[model samples]
Target chain A: MPFTMTAAALKIDHLGKRFGATAAVDDLSLEIAPGEIFGLLGPNGAGKSTTINMITGVTRPQTGSVSVFGYDNRRQALIARRLVGVMHQEIVIDHFFTVRQAIRIHVGYYGLPDDPGWRATLIERLGLGPHLAKPLRELSGGMKRRFMIAKAMIHKPRLLILDEPTAGVDIELRRSLWEFVREINGQGTTVLLTTHYLEEAEKMCGRIAIMNRGRLVALEGKETLLNRLGGRRLIVTLAQPLATLPAALAEDRSLLSWDPDHLTFAVAGPGAVGERLRRLALGGLHIADLDMRKPDLEEVFLQLTGNGNHHPAAEP
Target chain B: MTGPLPLPPFQPWLPFLTLLKREVLRFLRVSFQTLLAPVITASLYLFVFGATLGQRISVLEGFSYAQFVIPGLILMGIINNSFANTSTSLFMSRYLGNIVDLLVAPITAPQLILAYTLAAMLRGMLVGAVITLIALGFAPLPWVYPGLGLVMALLSSFLFAQFGLIAAIHANTFDALSMFTNFLLLPLIYFGGVFYPVSILPPFWEGLSRCNPLFYLIDGFRFALLGSGDNPFWLSFGISAAMAGGLFLWAALLIATGYRLRN
Candidate 1:
């Protein structure tokens, strides 16, 4: 593991940004270790992109600071920029150049000497060899995404920020992209990813941060986050219709949903699950069948934001 | 996609040089629209304005109207194309959202401005050269002070390219860019005394014409090219140079502050 006690690859402290009267990001703080694959998760307007922009020096923070590898973004902007690479969510390519030209140009922008063998290797590794001659505007979405990843990696920065990299990609391809990211992570590059796909975050990010309404709602190791904040779910298929609940159990009806032949509710944790079952049994109900669900990242996200819109992830 | 030529050793100037190369290549890629269009347009102007009007007006005592007007036409070519080069390049980059290339790069504000301005100068000078060549076909023109004429051409083009940069930074859409071009840029060119000398205007119009910056550019270029009047070429040079310097500073300030750019 490349994780260490050295300065963080990225550190954002008390960062804030406001547009007009609305706070896009509010006093957010985070420290991503040198070799960790960290995920920043949020609903559409949860300020995830604004945080990324601040980190990349595209948007200046009004309150605090962002540093890449100990170099402050604003004070040592050129040096910080040279040490980090970002692939924004928007797919913007210069139509004037081809993929080959576009990728090679990054070398000059960062003032790095070009290595043809490495360039060819990146092109081949990203499956961009065949499309190198095509104009950038002519490529399909998948190829463009791949090309953008290549562009981001051209300078070989120590840290890479990918904002929604697998967005709009098919399931199989999305998995492969994550596999490539894993390969890069294994090679000792720290990765910061923002993703709408909960399963993707669950599988890839060792740690995750969830944001809501311009605030950090949760930030923890994946398992820890799930255990602490992702409450368990239970569904009961009744032997008889849920009718005439006991007075004590009826008082908890706000958290319980009961239809003619089904009953559902959330269990706060392991202890709460048994207690809830005891209450249901005390109500003189026979349990025909029961289903218990393990909470995924989506459950945690929905619980935090109280919004289910993040799941579709395919939102255009 | 023609494979980029082999890379050289690393240097701090590489990014600036790379941007310059890309910008020069961008205009060259569309040679017909950027380079050839101005030449054909200048030729027609010379024939109609120079030939037909030469028989009627004599601004300078010893020269035909063709000789007197050629310098103005050449300077106009330089100004229009120089402005077009920077304005279209920056506006299109912003419009298409590819400006992220510069925003995220290690290039600084001064480097960005220099690269854009230098590319615009190349384009403006290229158009001026072709127009001057065509003017030679109209008559045998004297190259009185070719060096000074070149200096004036460069200074005027540099000034207008800064305007283009400013307009591009502030323009939100192509329509807004066109408004700058149509409303501000073209009017300055038309009233800048391209066909006839500003001396022919009434006292009030001539005073207004003198207030116009383009008038000094044409006046200086004409004085250097044909020695058409007693106006000192150095005076025109000083004014154009000062204005160019001022606009360059303004552009650098805008980039440094991230006005309408980083946001």
Candidate 2:
């Protein structure tokens, strides 16, 4: 089938995978266009990694097919693989080799002839010049992630697949790395990324697909997905502890919470905040502080995943 | 209007060569452990067995017992080194998560199998040659047919290398690979009549030894070295070649399917 956009980078059709008795990836389909940064947001075991593996030809799907830039992944695996580059979630490097040597070896595998200029440019672009001579074991977790990105981009592939690229990276480093990725995407390379940080996906990706229990639960534009969890929240800090909810605030009781020292209530619809304040004022309750909160990707993710437990420690 | 295609078709060999080069460089960088250690160990076996026990036995035909065990020592090195090289390399790649890099690359499965197997073969030959040279230091045996010996050594190395790759793919842990080597490969090498001629065994035991592929490999090399073997050289060569071909096809198929490499 012809894609909505002429330059389709990847197309996965009705893909399914099972590991013994457990279903790892269900009958899922997705499409990525050239020059687009598509985000795959999901909790652990959501089949995000499985999907990437299927697309990269690392794992064969039990049922269905995948195509890279229109080439069938199974029939024309070599052609498909050549067009795609992947940076895996785990940090893997040869501890003995220097960064320069490691990249050189990787570049050699793709059979690129010695191009000093391109190598130098990559080193500088990735901020790896200072660590070129340092052994991989000496580099921190963030540096290794960046090194993986540079290694994946060495062949100048048309599509780049990054699985949890910023899992342990610091905030500043993550932003800079995203900026670098944006620069690469601007040059027309399609990027498919899976991340746990919902904010990162909301900021970087125009389109997103959320996988849950090996199934695609939601797939749409970032805004469209966020809109699924309607309305906003208003958290009000009270001047004094309130013993009980006043009669005027009974209608919005579901959204209201009696904080030990601060009163926080969620507003379900537009202009509910004003009405809540009016009710509180009429009840003679004084507000010490008021804060407005919008529905971000995290809320939408929790709503869709349906597991209110937001424990980051459980993530892989 | 449609525009012409901007980029030319990419060359396929680039990724294959890249993987091959990496495999070669990995083993080559650690020649002391991978190359020299095997050579020294094989020589020790030759010295203790060929010099001590060989002297007690009467010379077979015109050749001495020391000369008789040379081919066995060399073949033993080929079998062990070839298996170790591929298995260790693949196991490390899997454990370190670098295999994903190759999995995601544009190279075909057959190419990957060939490249990895060839690197193992190179290591096998290097170790085998060192053992041969060490054997010569004790007893100088002329190669009855240098061409035949070279071909047999390479075929044996290729077969064992493919076996190693298969074992590595199936193995979930390093201990699993070690179990196969210690339990299967080690016993087979010792029982393959590498130390003594298979003629002295009981009828059933001798018959059983013939079933071991390593026997054909060692016997074929012995024939090439001393112009004498327990079985006809051509029969041994045919069996080894067929086994190697079958294993190569199986390895290629496993890699093509992504087997255990995929999640």
Candidate 3:
């Protein structure tokens, strides 16, 4: 088969995977364009990892087809795999080899000769210079993740796939890592990332696909996704406790919450924020402190997945 | 800052060689377990079996008992090491999930299989050579056809390595791998007449030994080393080569299907 460069770096069509009786990935399809960062956002067991496995040739989907850079993944796996690089969800490494040695071995697997120049560039890019000589066993959780990203980039693949790359990383490290990812994408490397950090997706991905129960429930631009979830919020905290909602504000009760001294409400849209404040003042509820939380990715994600459970901590 | 950089030129064989080197280095890094231990074990077998059995049985057609068993001992070492290397490497990679790195690479299944099996064969040959050298301490080992012995050893090593890879793919746990080694490999090697000729067995058992592929491998190596094999040299060579070919094809098929490598 001949090779051609195209606008879409990856095109997954009607992909589905079944493990005996359970369907792990169901009828998933998406198109990732070159130079674009795409996010696969979903909860655990939502088939995010399974979809990645299919795209990278680590696992075959029982039904449907995947094409990478115009090469069919199942039919031209070698070529497809050549164009893609994957950083798996698990932080697995050969404990025996130092970071430099591991990077060398990974580069070799792609049949690329060791280039000290390229290694140095990656070391600087991923902030791994200090840990170059350290074995994987000796590295901290965040450092190990950085090393994995560096390893994936060793071959300079056209398409990069990251499955939960920041699972155990700290906040500062994640910010820097996302910056590096942005730098790579700026250089025209297509990135397909699966992350639990909804904010990361909103910041990095041009397009996001939300998966749930082995199904692709939502796929759209970040702004469009948030718009679909409706509007922002206006939170009010009072100095005195309130036993019940004032009768005049009864119509907004579904969108409002009341505690002894704290009151919160979901503002329906831009116009609703003004009306909500006017009604609040009319009810004579004196606010001690008021905060308006913007409609962030977390709210959008919760509305789409229909689960209000907050992540214990934001993933790095 | 501007446009995307073009990918560097592709070098097809470079990755295969690198993976092969990694496999070799992995086994060599633990030479005490992969090489020296096998050699010592073979030597002990030679000392005990050759010394005790030679007193009862006359030298088998011009070769001493110690000399007669050397080929079988080397072949045995080759089989064990080859199988062990491939199976353990693959199983460990799978268990640790590092195999995903190989699977996602641009490398083909055939290249992956060849790199791994070739590494296993190299280790098997190294172990076999060490055992042959160790056997020299007990008695002077002669090779009627040094070239033929080398060829037989290599072919047998490749065969066993392929078998071990296939077993690794099918196995889910370490116990499954161990079961095949202990219940199948050990029995087949011993019953295939490594120490004694199959002609001394009951007619029924002798017929069964002919069916064991390892028997043909040992017979071919023994023919090259002693020139007094139980079967004709051509017959042993033909059977062993055919067995190797079948295993190679099966391994290729398994990898192509992405059998256990896929979810």
TM-score of each: 0.90, 0.91, 0.92
| Tens digit per residue, CA lDDT, model 3, B173-234 | 99999998999999999988788888778899999999987888898899898878889888
State which candidate, 1 or 3, has the greater TM-score: 3
Each candidate's fnat, in order? 0.56, 0.47, 0.63
Model 2 chain A poorest 10 in a row by lDDT: A307-316
Candidate 3 per-residue lDDT, tens place, A181-246, comes to: 888788878899999887788888989999988999899998898766455556788877888878
True contacts kept of 1: 0.56
> Could you give candidate 1's per-residue lDDT for residues A63-170 as a string of tens digits?
999988777889988877887888889998888888988887877888887879878877877789999999998999988988888888888777899999988766
Q: What digit string (tens of lDDT, one per residue) describes model 1 on residues B118-177?
A: 999999999999999998888667888889888899998899899999999999988999
Instruction: Give lDDT for model 2.
Output: 0.81
Sort order, DockQ high to low: 3, 2, 1
DockQ top scorer: 3
Which candidate number has the best TM-score?
3
Q: What DockQ number belongs to candidate 2?
A: 0.43
Query: Clash totals for all models, in order?
Result: 0, 2, 1
Q: What is the DockQ of each candidate?
A: 0.38, 0.43, 0.47
Ranking by TM-score: 3, 2, 1
Computed on alpha carbons, the lDDT of every model, listed in order, comes to 0.83, 0.81, 0.82
Tens-digit lDDT track of model 2 for B180-236: 899999989899978778877899999999998888888898888888889899999
- List of clashing residue pairs for candidate 1: none
Candidate 1 has a TM-score of 0.90
Mark the regions of model 3 whose C-alpha exceeds 4 Å error after superposition.
Answer: A1-5, A253-258, A268-271, A281-284, A309-316, B1-7, B50-59
